[model samples]
Structure formats: C-alpha cells, structure tokens
Target: MDLHEYSRYDAVGLRALIVAGEVTAAEVESAARRALDRVNPEVNGLASPVFETALGHAGAGPFGGVPFLLKDSGPMAEGVEFFAGSRSLRGVRARHDHDLTRRFRAAGLAVLGLTTAPELGLSYATEPARTGPTRNPWDLARGVGGSSGGAAALVAAGAVPMAHANDSAGSVRIPASCCGLVGLKPSRGRTPTGPDSGDPAFGALAEFALTRTVRDAAHLLDAVQGPGVGDKYTAPPPPRPYADELGIGPGRLRVAVTVRAWSGVAVDPEVAEVTLKTAELLAELGHDVTEASPALDWEDVVHGTEAAEAAIAAPFLTAPGRPDPARLEAVSRALLAEAAELSALDLVAMLDAQNRVSRVVGAFFTGYDLLVTPTLGELPPPHGTLSSGEEGHTLRGWLEKLFAHGPFTVVFNLAGQPALSLPLGHSVGGVPIGVQFAAPYGREDVLIRVAAQLEEAVPWRDRIPPCFASKP
Candidate 1:
C-alpha cells in the first residue's frame, strides 16, 4: 500500500486489510518505514530504530504486521535498549519483557523502534539531552508534551496508527493534547507493570496509548488491560470490552467542569475559553455540566507528589553502576540530591498524605460521574521555555514552574483515577487544545462512552498535522 493509504487507517483498519488479504504485513511495514523516513528527520520523534526486529514479528498477533513504536522510558520490550531519554543509561537493555510489552507482542504489534522522552521521564518536554527534542507535528517550534511526546508525534505525523505510551502526571494526556490525538490513562493497576517494577511512583503512574481515534484507544486497552503475575494491585474488570462502549450513548449524567487549576495557577484565556466551549458542547448533548472544581488541600498534594517521586527516584540514584554525574542533567542531579536528603519516615508521611488526598478527591467524585478540565493550562509552549538547565532555580523552584504550566492533569495521577484527554478544540493561534475528562477509579468505560459522544459531536480525526505522512 502507498503511504497515504497506510496512514489513513487506524490499527484495526490496517489489521482488517491484512486479514482480508487485501495487503501484506510486509507492504504495511514498508509504508510505515517510508513514513518514518519521510517525517522522522523533521519531527525528531524516533530515538532508535529496530526495523529488522519489527520485520521478524510481522504476522505474530491480532495486529501482526502493523508497525508500532514503544516509548523509550518504560513499557519495555525484552532486549530493547531502554535509555529513558538519559545518556547515563544509554546502552541499558531490558533483560526481560515487562508484562505489558509481552502482551503487545502477543497481540501482534510489530515493534518498530523506541521513541524519544524527556530525561528520566521527569520533564514535560521531550527535549532529551541525549536525543534532542521531539518536535510537535502540529508546529515544529512548539513542544510536544512528554515523556510520551515521541509516541504522540509519530502517530500524529502518521508514522504509526497508535503507539505505546504511559502516563504519570499527564505524560500521555499532555502530548495527546499538544498533538491532537486521543490519550487515555487507564485506572491504576488497569495495566500491569510487573516482574521489573510494580506501582511505580506510589500508584501515581498508569500505562496506555495515544491514538488518532477513540476506538483505537479502546481496542488497544482490550489488548493490554488486566493484572500480571505477582502484581501488587488489580483494577476491577469491566463488564464488557471497552471498545463496545464506543458509539453508545453515555446516558444523562452529571459532569463537573472547571477551568480553575486545582493549585490556583492562572490558566491562559484561550485555554479557558476552549474548556468552557467544551462544557457547553457537553451540555448541548444533554449531560448536566456545571462549573465546579474538586476541593483539596493543594499544598499537601504538591508535597505528596514530590515526596512520592523522590522515593521512586532514590533507587535509581543509588543503583549499582549508576550513570556518571556528567551524563546527568542539572534537574536530574538536583532531584537526586533532594531524594538523598529524605528519610524513610518522610517518604511514609508523604504516602499518608497522598492517601488522605485520594480519599478527599474520591469523595468529591461521589457527587458527579465525571470531572472535566483543560489538559494543560497553556497552549504548547515553545521549546526551551521550560529548560531544566536554566540557572538560579532550585529543583523545587523548577518543579513549581513546570507545574504552573501543566497544573490541571497531575492531580488525577495522584488520585489514581482514569483520565482521558480529547482533542476537542484548537487555540486561536491554531494549536490543538485538549479537554480532559476524568472518572472515578475503574470507570474508563464511562470516560470512553462520553469521549465517543464528544468525538461524534466535535470530530477531530480529520484535523491532520502539517507534518503528517498522508500529505501526499
């Protein structure tokens, strides 16, 4: 198939063509490679290529022969070098497939290569010191949100139909927002991270993908959800496949809408306008939408998140054969120093506060079926606007600055609830603006249905980026 034909189909559509004998997996792989060749140089999304490895996996599972990219930070496939956007661990390779990677292979996704990420997945931008920046497909100078920025850029540019991505504090959703895609962070424990790590970041992390269609996100979830062996936690099973919820009405429900940042960070006027417009659209669809924000102690949530991340960072700093200091960035070094200062008791106290905040946020959800907010507080900022290398800011000061730019999405990560970012509108400057819909834990089914409703109401699939592969 030609690149245009290949770029037009989502994974399911590509799979259907392969299954129907209308196209060969080899042909599709070639099309994807052509896409990579055509766009990767300009977009800077790919960190490394595993084209030969991908060729060997063609025809292996449900998506056998469909090209797929794995985010460099996590969701590792066995033997794939995992640099995590760090030069320090540049040659590190996973000894075994994390459960999710094994599932992706079994489901027939041909792993093409690794995508770029911010160093250690810590930054909201994908400008890794080691791999440089992964440019936004929408506008090259603007940042593609990280650490899943590479994955989102490739899919947005039509290098792949959908790619693996994970979210801890909006990595997946932020990029989806910036790149005009569908990004879903499944409920905590909904996707496994086992035999290597479990519940990383103290249950603040969840894994899923960035897709061009809501159905692709739903189908990919069907392929990857469920607990792995020796998992520390598991989400309650859905009554039916998540994909079945698509095109189905979500029923009349109460959805709380807020343009106010939980931390009181001032949102850009354009972003707030887009969010209110989305709320109006939801109301037009017969759902009750009201202006409301969750009640929580913002200080405790911020402190708790920092403590949890430090606790997670501590091991990496002290791990045997750790990266040399020269290879580490200032922000990473500062974070490591912060982690070194924390006592075990401090970590425990942070966990306790997080649990308390989770309960408070959970109770707020009791009054509404869903909460909606702008995925990011501002439009995608220009590259280098958030440089960790900037002098004079302490690590904590730098983090606060970062949060001010993206204060809306991280709270749900702390709460371990399912959240999705939908590309429902665009900024006056023409950049994409995604609206976030968060549901109570284990309620992705609700989020998906409502997203589909919004998808039908304000379609975004035809809004292709300038760097798109189907441009021919």
Candidate 2:
C-alpha cells in the first residue's frame, strides 16, 4: 500500500480492507511504518519505536492488524518502556500488561511504539526535557498539546489511524484540539487504570485513544469500554455498542454554550469565534441552544487538581532510590516538594471540593444535555510557551499557567463526565481549532452522536496539514 492510500483510511476503514482480503494486515503495518518513518522526523512524535515487535504481532479481532501507538505515559504494555514523559522513570519497563493494553491487543490493534509527552504528563505542551518537543504537524513551530501530544501529532500527520491517549486535566482533548483529531475522554471509569491503580489522579484520569474520525472513536470505545478486575468504580454501560451511536441524530436536545471560562482566563478571539459559530451551527441543526454555564469556584477546581497531582507524584518521588533532582524536571521537582507538604487533611479538602463541583455540574447537566466550549482558551502556542523544565515554578503557579492555556477541559475531569474535542474549525492562519462537546456522566453515547453530526456538518477529514506524511 502506498503512503497516500494508507493515510486516507481511519482505523475502521483499514480494518475493513484487511478483513476483505483486499490487503493483508502485514501490508497495512508496513505502510504505517513507512508513514511513521516519513513523518516522525519532522514531528518528533515517537518517543520509543518498537517496530520489530509490531512486525511479529498478528492481532485478531474487530480492528485486527490496525497500526497503533501507545503513549509513553501509559496504560502499560509489559516489556515496553513506560516513561510518563519523565527522566525519573527512564529505562523502566512494565512487568505486566495494563488491563487496557491487553484490551487494545485483544481488539486487534498492533502496538508500534510509544509516543512523546510532557514530563510527568503535566504540561499542555509536549516538550519534555527527556524527549524534546513533539511539534504540531499543522505548523511545525507550534506545539501539539501535551501528555497525549505525541499521539495527537502522529494521528494528525497520518502516521497511524489512532493511538493510545489518556486524559487527566485535558491531556487527550487538549492535544486533539491542537492537532485536528478526535479526542474522547470517556467518563471516569469508562476505561480502566487497574491492577496497578484502581484510579489514577483521584478519579480524574480517563484512558482512551485519539482518532481522526468520530466513528473511529465510537468503534474504539465499543472495543475497550468496560471495567477491569478490582477497579474502584465502573461507569454505567452504554445500552448498546458505541459504534451504533454513530449516524443517529441526537434529536432536538438542550445544548449550553459558553465561551467564558470559569477560571476567568480570556479566550482568544479566534477560538471564541469558532465556539460561538459551533453553537450557532447546533442551533441551525434544530437544537435548543442557549448561553449558559455552570457556576464553579475556580480555586476549588485548581486546588483539587493540585492535590490529585501531588498524590500521583508521591509514590514515584518518595519511592526507594527516588530519582535525583537533577534527573527530574523543574515542575516535577516542584510537585515533589508540594507532595511532601501535602497532608491527609489537604486530600480530604480536595475530595470535598470535588464533591461540591461534581454536584453543581451534575445539576447543570440535569437541565442541559450537552455543553459546548473551546477546548483551549488560546490557539496552540509556540514551543517554550509552557515548558515543564522552566525553573522557579511553584506547583500552584505552574497549574495556573496550565489552566490559563486550557481553561475549558480540566473542569470535566474534576466532574468525571464524558467530554470530546473535535477539530471543527480553523484559524485564519490555517491552524486547526477544536470545539469541545461534553456530556453528563456516563453519556459517551450522547457525545458520539453529536460529534458524528458535527463531523458531517464541518468536514475536516480532507484538511491535511502541510507536514503530512502522505505529502511526498
């Protein structure tokens, strides 16, 4: 298969070709490797390439033979190096396959390698001191949003149809917004963090993947959505396969639109214009659209997130033979200090705040079926704009900077609701702009339905980036 032919297909499309004997899985995998080789140099998306292992893989299932990449910050796959974009965990490998990784393999996604991330998955920019930066394919000088930033960049550049991504405070959706891809942060517990952790980041993290199309997102959710053994909680199951949700009209539902972020970060005019236009389009599509926002104490959200992050960092930072300060990034060191200062009472306060915010947002959702907002407050910033390696950052101050760039996404992580970012619009400069659609808890079906509608309404599939893998 040629790079152009390979790049045009989504995961499902590729799987169909493999299933029909039109092309073998090996051929598809070869095309993916070629695509990766062609683009990874320009985008710097691959953190660890395991191409040899992928060649030996003969996956079987709905997506059998589909090329996939795992994020360096994991849903761990045994034997693959697991670095959460930090030097502290450098050279470490998972002893066991994370439940989600097993599920990906079972569903027939051939794991190619690991993608880049910000150190400890902290920043919205994927410029880790350990792996440099994963540049945005749309504009090489800008960043692909972080944590899942590498996954987003590869998928955007047509290296792979979809790849593993996780979100705690917008890691998945932020990068999706920046890269013109489909980033679905399933409801908390919709996918597992299991045997290693019942819940990561105090139930704030949601494990999933980034894809180019809404149907691909839906199909993947169908393949991987379920609780793992010993999970702390499980999301209510969808009534049917998530793939069935596609092509179904969402009906005339109540949709709330807000360009103003609760954190009071000023939305860029271009981003605000895209979001408002999306709302108008929803109205045009016959939905009841209204300007409404749930009341939130931005401090509570920020504090709770800080506490969760500190807790996540504690185990690593306090471990036997913990990484030296020189081995860790500045923000990570700051996090270690913050974790040391955190008391049990601080965690309790975080839970209290989480409960309060979830309750308020839950109530708001009782009235509105969906909420529309810009995925990020600003466009994808230039490299160095949000570096974790930069010195002298207090944990709070660093989070403030992070939230300012992505004020719209972390709230839903706090609320444990399902949210998705779709590349629905673009800037006049030709960079993609993402508009996020969030649903109430356990309502991914709603998100998929609406996202598919928008996918059809504002077609972004043909809008390839200049640094595309297929381009010569």
Candidate 3:
C-alpha cells in the first residue's frame, strides 16, 4: 500500500494492510509523519512529533503501523513531557509509561505524536499560549473543541484515523462534534486511569479516545477496556466482544430523544434538526423512537455540578508531597475554596444529589435502551470562549457557561453510564455536529453496539475535511 493511501486508512483498514504485509508499520508511521509536516502547520493540532519511537514499535498489535496521537492530558505520555494545555507545567515530562499508553502501543498503534488540549482540560477550545490555535480542519476560524481539540483537528485533517482523547466533561465529544468523528466515553472504569490516582472523583468519569470511524472506536475499546492492576472500579463485564456485537442488529431500541437540555436552553436549531433527523433514521431502522425527557434538574446540576466534580477531583489537584499549586485554574481554585468550607454534612448532600441525578436518568432507561440528544447544545465555540484565568466572570460562572454551552454530554459523566458521541449530523455551514447516545451503567457493549449501528446508518468516514484531502 502506498504511504499516501495508508495515511487515509482507518484503524481497521490500516491493521488489515499491515497484517497482509502489503504495507509495513514503518511506512504508516512515515506517511503519518509526512502528514504532520503537511497539515500541522495549518492546523497546529500536533503538540510534539515522535516517529522514531513509533517506527521501532510498528507491527505491534491489531492496529500495527496505524498512525495515532495522544491528547496530551491523560496518563499515556508519562516521561514524555505532557503539558495538559496549561502554562503552569509547560516543561513537564512523563517519568514513566502510563499503562494506557502501553496498551495503546501493544495494540499496534504507532503513535507519532501528541495532540493539543486546552489548559488543564478546563476549556473546550484548544488554543493555548504555549501552542498556537489548533484550527478546525472544516473551518480555520472555528474551534476544534478541547481538550481533545488537537486530536479532532488532526484526525479531521486526515493526519491520522483517530487519536486518544478523554472527557471528564465533554472534552472528547465536543471535539468530535467540531471535527466530525466518532467519540466514545466509555462507562467509568471502562478504561484505566491508574498508578497516580484510583479514580477522578464521584467515580463518575474516566478516560477514552475519539476516532473518525465507529469500527475503529469499537475495535480499540475491545483492545483496551479493562481495569489495570489497581483501578478503583470496573465497568461491568461487556456482554460480548464489542467488535463482534457490532454485527448483531439492535432490535428496536426504545429510543428516547431529547433536544432540549435540563438547562432550559433550546437546542440550537441546527443541532435539533440533526438530532430529530437521527431519531427518524433510527425509527426507519425499525427502532421505536419517541420524543421524551427525564426529570433532569438542570438548574441544580449546572448551578453547582462543578463543585461536586471538583470535590471528587481534589486528590489530582495536589501530588503527595509538594503540591503543584501553579497548575490550578480559577474554577479549580474556587472549588477548592468551597471544599474547605464543606463539612461532612455538605459532603453527604453532594453525593446524595449526584446519585439522585443519576437515578432520574436511569429510570428513563427502564423504558428505553438509550437516550439521544445533541452532544453539545450549541456548535463548536470560537477559540477562547471559556478562558479560566479570572477574566470577568467568577470561576463558577465560567464553568457554568461551559455547562450551558455543552449541557448535553456531561451528565453521563455524573451518571456513571456508558455514553458515546456519534458523528452523524452537520450544521448548514458544514461544521460537524454530533449526537450523543447513552446506555445504562455497566452496558458499554450496548453503547458501542448502537454507535456502530448508527455509523452504518449515516456514514461519516467520507467527510474528510479539505485540509486533509489536499495532502492525500
């Protein structure tokens, strides 16, 4: 296979070619490197390039020689200087290989570099002072949402089929929506977050990646989903290999679709149109689709959800001995301040409230296999829309603003359920739009299966942005 062609292949295709010996992993790495050279300049998606190590590790797993990038926020790039899109740790380097990155390498992905992310994964837009703006491949001026913004940009630009991304909030889905890709944030504990901390508070959310192809996303989930040696929790065992289950038809799901969020913000007309269109498509596929919503107390969640999430996220704020106070964002600072004032009673109240929100959502699943909504209420934001360095709004206001802008995707993080963002719709301006589908807790197999089903319904693989197509 020509390197040019390999650059365009999705994970499955690249792996097949590598197995067939028609192409070598080295060649894929080379092609991906060339792609970075061609596209990174225009998009600023790649934070650092690493082809040499990738070449040495080609033909390693199911995705041998497949080009991929890490989002720079998670545990994967230990000893490799992960900036996490913040100025505070601009020169930080990974001291060890996170098990997740090891698993990714073992699965045969030749990771050639790191993708861009916003400061501390705090903002949805990916422009950081350390790295210039990571432009959306679809529209240069438009944002490639954070913190996986850079990965979205690169993959949308065809630099790679997929890249690693995680979402505590909508970090993964927001970018996937902006860049037109499939992003699955598996159930909490579906993927490892280990060694440093057992879980990031509330046990609500964890790590996963975004990809351009549903099949690729599903395949990686199979290769990587499991608790490492010392994880706090594990998603209940999947019914079957997710890749295998994709072949099984999703018999008429009692699909409940809601375009309006708990916040009372009307879903953007464009997002609503696509969400409804997707529901109709699901109905045509013989699934029962209904317009419905759960009793989501949006005002309550948005008013103080960050405080709850922050309380859960406290350990990660400081290391064992010397705390890295510099990396704390304004929102983080606000939460810490609140946490100090919180008593045992307040802690109980917070946990109880979080559970109640999840219960409200879970009850709806009793009547439906899944819930569908616009992944983000609005479209991709302009760069710097949610800056956190104490600008005008208070830290809580900034976070609340983000929740308002992206009201749809974070509840699952709170619900501890498996949710996925499927890239099946678009705005009239041609910006990519995403629809979120969530399954009950411990049923990632269902989430991935439905996502694959939708992938077949409305294919997005061919919508590669012009920036990527130009090189190939």
Per-model TM-score on C-alpha atoms: 0.97, 0.98, 0.92
Better of 1 and 3 by TM-score: 1
Name the regions of candidate 3 deviating beyond 4 angstroms: 1-3, 49-52, 55-58, 307-317, 320-345, 469-472
Which candidate number maximizes TM-score?
Answer: 2
Clashing pairs in 3: 61-108, 78-94, 79-94, 79-95, 80-94, 81-93, 81-94, 124-146, 201-312
Q: What C-alpha RMSD separates each model from the true structure? A: 1.4, 1.2, 2.5
Candidate 1 clash figure, as a count: 1
Q: Give the clash count for model 2.
A: 1
lDDT of 1 by residue, 129-191 (tens): 888888998899999998799999999999999998988789999999999999999888899
Check candidate 1 and list the clashing pairs.
Answer: 61-108
Off by over 4 Å in 2: 55-58
Which is superior by lDDT, 1 or 2?
2
